[model samples]
Every structure is written in C-alpha cells, then in structure tokens.
Target: MSLPFSPQSSLHQRLRVGLGTMLVPLIMLAGGALISFEGAVGSFEQQDSISRQALFPLAEVEGEILELTSVATHAQPTNTMTLQNYRRKQLVIKSQLALLSDYFQGQPTKFNSVQEIRRQWLEIARLCEQIFEATEPEQLANAKVQLSQRLQGILKNTQELNYRLIAFQNEANFDKARAVREKVRYLVAFISLLALALALLFAFYLSRSITDPLQTLAKGVEKLGQGELHHRITLETQDEFNHLAETFNLMANQLEQSQQDLYRLATLDGLTEVYNRREFNRWLLVEIERSQRGEHPVSLIMVDIDHFKRLNDTYGHQAGDLALCEVAQLLQREVRPGDIVCRYGGEEFGVILPKATSADSWVIAERIRLAIAEKSVVLPSQQHIDMTASLGVATYPDHADCKERLVKQADQALYTAKYQGRNRVHSAEVNECNHQINKLQRMLVKQGT
Candidate 1:
C-alpha cells in the first residue's frame, strides 16, 4: 500500500533530482529515504502506528550506517566513487534521523536516545573523514579498524533505541507523535499537492530543454550520415550539451574539409588546377548519357599546345608548367559554366560541351585557339613566352555515338590541324573521319612498336 499523505507521490521517481554538497564520498544515489518512505508507510500497523513509523526508518538508518562503515573500510582508497556514495548516503541517513527526532519531542528520556544517536553520528562522520583521508595502507588499516568498532557501537545504541521505541517509553511521546502525525498529514497533503504541480511543470520544462537539443543533434547526425557535410548542430543551453554540440560541429567541419581535399587530390590536375584526365573521361561519359536521354547534341574539343616540346626545350620545364596553368585558366574563363575544361594529358586539354551543336563547338574551338595564341605566359626569370594551340572539334552522333569513337575523331582532327600547321582549329569532317581514325591508330601502333 502507498502512503496516504499527498507528499508521498513518486514524483521523485519520475522526475530525477540531484543534490550536491561536500560531506563524504562515492556516487548517484541522492534520495534513498524516499524509497524507504514507501516501505515505512506500508509497514505501519494501525494498532501501533507510532512505533512502526519511527522504528522502521530507524532500523533502516542503522543498517545503512553499518553498510557505509563496511563500504568505507573495504573500498579502495583511491576510488572517487566510494566517497561520493558515502556522502550521499550520509545525507540520506541524516534525513532519516531528522524524521525520527520529530517523534521524540516532549519526551526527555526517549529524546536523549535520539541525541546520543546524533552524537554517535558525529563521531562516525569523523571516522569517515579519517578513513577517506588516509593515504597509506597502515593509516587506512587503523582507520578501518576504528570505524568498524565505532559503527558496531552506533548499531548497538540504535538497537537499544529501537527496543525503547517499541516498548513505548512515554504516553506523552505517543500522544505527541499521534498529534504530530495529524498535523503532518494535513501539511504533507498541501505540500504534496504543491510538489506535484511543480514536478509536472519541471518535468515538462526539463523534457523540452534536454530533448529538443538532443533531437537537433540526432538530426544533424543523420544529415552527416547522408553526406550533407555542411550540416551543424545548434545547442544553446549553457551546459554540457552546448559543449557536446560544439564537438560534433568541429568533427563535421574537419570531415568536410578532409573530403574536399581528397576530392581535389583525386580529380584536379596538380599543376593546372583544371579537371584532370580521369575526371574528364568520367564527365565525357556522363554528358554523353545526358545528351542521349535529351536527344540533344554533345561536342568534344581536343586541344594540344603547338610545339610544346620545343617550348620546354627552349624555356625549361618550369616555363612549360606555367604556360599550362595560364592556358587552363584562360580556357576556364572562355567557356560557359556548363562546359568542363580538363587537362587531358601532357601538353593536351579536353573540353566537354553538352547540348551544343557542331557549329557552336567550332566557334568555341576557334575562340580557345585565338586565346592561346594571344596569351603570353611570364616565366620565373621575368621572360614572356607566347604559346599557341591546335584545336579539334567533334560533335556527338555527328562524329560517332560512342565516347571512344568521338575521342578518336577529335584526336584525328587535331592531328590533321597539326599536320597542316600548328596554331589553328579543325572540325572533324564526317566524310573521312573513320579513315583518318584508322590511319591514326595504325600510326600509333607503329610508334608503340
């Protein structure tokens, strides 16, 4: 059976509370008397309500004291948790003593027992300090032996008080306990009502306060998992939750930066900062697929720096690298956002133009060729070097549907431009593109051998 007093609700069990103060050692148990209260209320017999109420909690307090002594004596001296629990249980036992003390008012003889118990508790607490504060094995061993004896004496006195409480030492103590219970019953009833309301309000506020940030953090984690690298957690509580949110955001930032570094290393040219050959090939296939779906034309322009070997031979490799970077940046400026400019290979670049016609691509190729011929790259020694490029433009479905065939057609046209003269643009003529491609392949095979 539960307590009839309104203050007796499990509001405590439902809404967790923590209390902190400096007394002793060990850990999370803050309110154990409340747990014992239910038992105290249930263990009461109507025939002798005073004896049961006072004696039950008293016996529990005695037991807890013994347990604390055992724990203090045997527990590791370095264990921080032992001290925290010892402190918390000490408070709990203190509360129990307070409740029992209330029952002995006006009865001097019975009340002295309560006073002696309090005195013994002070001695026990002193022992507790000595036990926890002891650093060496010898000091700790002496403290433990003394604490065990002190607790045994405390327990013996507590038992005597229990026997006297059961015997009903005075009619005044009984009559007062009964009168006090009535007043307390009404007082607890009112306070319990107030406490219930407060607990509900606190529960609502605490739930929102704690759960809202946790929900935000949980959602942020989910977004990060789905590759939303820019996602961050926003916890505004000036507490540990805020610190946790900061840690999570920091982790996300580092991960996003790491991913970007990896992406650049994988797909961008080291020297030119343009899309590299690998990315170019990948985007070429992607653009072709998009064009196939839309039934729109896609174009490829293959550009090669004219007499690049001669430039390196004359100016040095550093100048050649500078020229490549300058040309790549110029190509990027000349093209639309939709177009992709890539460093195709040594002294070569490829441009993918989606949804563009052969005529459009031809104009772009001419513009690129003109830009390369006009731009002068400054060398490290303050020397200027003018570079020129030969460009070959080929349209998809006009040149060939496959990426390989399209590349071959553009490459062959570029060869044809170089064959006629170096700094000019040539479009792949469909009439002889296959013949030119076969001839180029045969030449490449011969060069390989």
Candidate 2:
C-alpha cells in the first residue's frame, strides 16, 4: 500500500510534511542547546560587567584616598585649601562606593565587600576632618599622626579588595575559556548531525519535487528553440516552477508576436508605413524580370512634394512630416491593388504599376497630384496647411527597357515637371525628342554617321 504522505502528493503538501518532520526535532535540539549556552554566556557577561564598572571605579577611589592622605599630613596649620582638597576627595570616594554598591546589588557577597570598604572610607574621612578642625601647632601634629594611621588601614582594605577582584576575574576567564571549548564541541557535533539530516532530506525532496519538473521544462525549452513557438509548459504542482512555466509561456507568446511585427517593419517604411526603398527596389527588379519574359510594359511614377522645404520653414517640420504622410495615404488610396506604392526617399515617392502603359501611369500620377492639392493637413497647433505635388511617369520597353534606366528616365521627367512649375505631371514619352537627339549623338560617335 502507498504511504499517506508520498512523493506523488502535491509539492506544497510534501514540503509541509517534510518541514514538519525535519524542523520539530531540530528546533527541540537547538532549544536545549541554546538554554545551556545562554546560561554560560550570562555568567561570562556578569563577570565582565563587575570588572569594568565596579573594580575600575574602586581602584580610582583608592588612588584618590592615598592622595588625600598625603595632602592632609603635609598641610601647614593655616592652609584652608588643604581642608578643601580633603573634603573633595572624601566626596568622590563616597560617590564611587555608592556606584559600586549599585553594580553589585544582585550579589550579596560582592555588595558586602563594597559595604566594608565604604565603612573604612568613612573612618578615614573622619580623621581628615579632625585634621582640618585642629588649629594649634600641637593639635595639628597629633591629627596628622591619626590621619596617617587611618590611611594605612584604608589602604590595606583597598589592596585586599583589589586582590579579591583580580582573583575572581581570573576564575571567570578560566570558566569562560572552558565554556567556549565545550560550546564549540557541542555545536560542531549538533550542526554536523543536523546538516547531514538536512542534506539527505533536501536531496530526496529535490529529486522528487524539482528534478522532474525542470527536466520537463528543459524539454519544452528545447522544443521552443527548435521553432515550436506554440509549445507550452504545463506544471500542476502550483509551486514557483509552475509560475516560471506560466511566465515562460507568456514570453513565448510575446516572442512570436514580436517576430511577426519585426517582419512587417522590415518590409514597410517607418514613417509612411508603405513599402520602403529597399523593398521597392526588390519588387521593381522582380517586376522588370517578369515584364522582360512576357514582353509586357511596366510603368514607374516618381513623385516629389513641391516646395516641401519652404513648407517646413513656414509651418515647421512637423507639418511637413504630416504632409508627407498625408500624400502617401492619398497615393495609396488612388493606386490600384496591383500597383505598389513606396517611399522612395526623403520627400519623394515611387509607384510601380505592373502591365500598365505610360498613359495609364500618367493618369494615376495626375490623380494623386490633384488629390494632394485638394487635401489640407491639420498640424498639432490646430492650423491647416494646403500642399501640392509634382509627378513624372515612365514606362519600360519604351523608355530605356531596363530597371535602372527606366527609374532614371522617370526621375528626369520629374525634374522637368518641377522646372515647368510645380503641381504638374509629365512623361518620358513627351521628352522623346531629347532621348532621340542623345541616341543620334551616340550613334555619330560610334560610326561617324
């Protein structure tokens, strides 16, 4: 029979069960270890606190007492400043002893020692006071003897306390060192066992939970790389890997859409969204080859926006761009489905009419010119600008019979239309006289005819 909690269960259920089984024992072990360690640590901190706050202040007070005793013994009978110094030292020593009492309040033994020191200090202060009160030379000399004896007693007590604190501190250091050694050994053993258990659990969980899903995802990725854009990753565990699969599916969809958009951008113009110059050249070459094989005519019309620079200077470049786009839209609308419209260059456009003659191309060009002349482009400033265009038409097998020459002939015709006053359509056939004269000149050069 299968177990109640098995590998075939959901990843969340498996993870919950695994963590519950693993962490309970680990936490129990860690709790016991922490309690022991914290007790040792607390003892070490208390020793450190007593040494810094209590012992150091006690030493300072002892030094002050010695200084006061020396000053009291050597003071002249009328030197009031000596009494003031003695009073100041007495006050400082009392304050330090009070502070030490506060630090050792929790320990009855240490507090008792501080109380003993305070009692001895009070006796010494009383002797200093007696010396301050003595006025006669004989009285001052006797007070100095008593003050010296009181100082000796206080010094002996202070030395004893200092030695006790040092011994206690050394014992604390030894205990701290031993505790640290024991803690290190326990921690190493406990952590090694815990880590070993966790490593085994993790290895088992990873193989069950992650490895199969990742292998499936890897295969999906391989399929996607091989152009299986429609392929998707399906995971049912509802884990992070499931989320990753969903994101991967989204990325694949976006990539497929982006590829389509990129292909469209490659063949279309960025501004006018018509066939770009490169695409135009490619289409024209294909049309020319087909025309040559069929002995049929193919026409090309070249268009220019007349006074476009002046329009840009007058209204701004934005208006000029709008005008260009509007003109492209007009040409696209007027041209037949079989014809291809292209943005030839800056402020110029070309249309390829397959199986069309010069007359038909010229008529279409004239229609485009009229449409542009009637159209008004509204600028971003809410201003309208009217514009016009010049067109030139040329046909293959009648105008140079080759793609390059046909385009050149059309361009030349366009130049003539611009020179004859803008907003007009002209044809290469209308300029046949110039072509015949050039041909005769070439023949003359070749044969002296």
What is the Cα-based TM-score of model 2? 0.45
lDDT of 1 by residue, 367-418 (tens): 9989888999898788888889999999987887579989999999999999
Backbone Cα, N, C clashes tallied per candidate: 12, 0
Which ten residues in a row are the worst by lDDT in model 2?
1-10
**What TM-score against the true fold does each predicted structure earn?**
0.57, 0.45
Worst 10 residues of 1 by lDDT: 19-28
lDDT of every predicted structure (CA atoms): 0.80, 0.83
Q: Can you tell me which runs of candidate 2 are displaced by over 4 Å?
A: 1-245, 257-265, 293-295, 430-449
